[model samples]
Target: MKTAVSIPDRIFEAAEQYARRRGIPRSQVYAEALARFMAEQESDEELTEALNRVCAEVDTSLDEFGRAAARRVVLPASEW
Candidate 1:
């Protein structure tokens, strides 16, 4: 399928660079990105809803919230 879409110069340049670095055609890069983006969009809505439910439960239980926070260790900025 062939379609024409106009993109900003900066975005085009970045995509071209990424395609060159990955040794793939620009179309393939765009296709992969679009697929990933669509998948995320489809799943994010459900994930967000689940997270909201969990957060609502946390509001009623500080212990649960504390345990959840403790499970995630904060790393130093240098690691990032």
Candidate 2:
């Protein structure tokens, strides 16, 4: 696919230098960068979905003793 977009002159110069040094086209550099970015975004979504599923299956309620312990751990000053 062909597209056009704007970027900072400094970043363009750096990408140009990188492509020139590696003897690869500028398009490949941009394509690889976009691919890595998309992969990371997808991985983050997958991690969030997996965490939600695990949280849904576990017990989240606290008993009286557990609540007291949690309060002491959180506040540590007031009498229970």
Candidate 3:
């Protein structure tokens, strides 16, 4: 698929240099960058969903008690 979007001159120059050095098409470099970015976003979304599920399953009282205990045992950075 063909797409056109403008980028800063410096970033364009750098990406061109990167593509030339790696002996790959400029389109391939942009494609890989987008692919990696999308993958990271998906991974982060999945992790957040899993964490929310687990947190919802745990007892709120237990969680609050742990927080209270941590407050008692943990010292302020200034004190440390």
The RMSD of every model to the true structure, in order and in angstroms, is: 7.7, 4.9, 4.0
Instruction: Kindly report which residue pairs in candidate 2 clash with one another.
Output: none
* Clashes per candidate, residues 3 or more apart or on different chains: 0, 0, 0
Select the stronger candidate by lDDT from 2 and 3: 2
| C-alpha positional error of residue 38 in candidate 3 after TM-score superposition, expressed in Å | 0.4
Better of 1 and 2 by TM-score: 2
lDDT of 1 at 12: 97
Poorly placed runs, candidate 2 (over 4 Å): 61-80
Q: Candidate 1 has what TM-score?
A: 0.58
Q: lDDT per residue, candidate 1, 1-80, as tens digits? A: 99999999999999999999989999998999999999999899989999999988875554866766655654332364
Instruction: Report clash pairs, candidate 3.
Output: none
lDDT for 39 (candidate 3):
100
Cα lDDT of model 2 by residue, 5-70, tens digit: 999999899999999999999999999999999999999999999999998999878899899998
Q: Which clashing pairs does model 1 show? A: none
- Lowest-lDDT window of 10 residues in candidate 3? 71-80
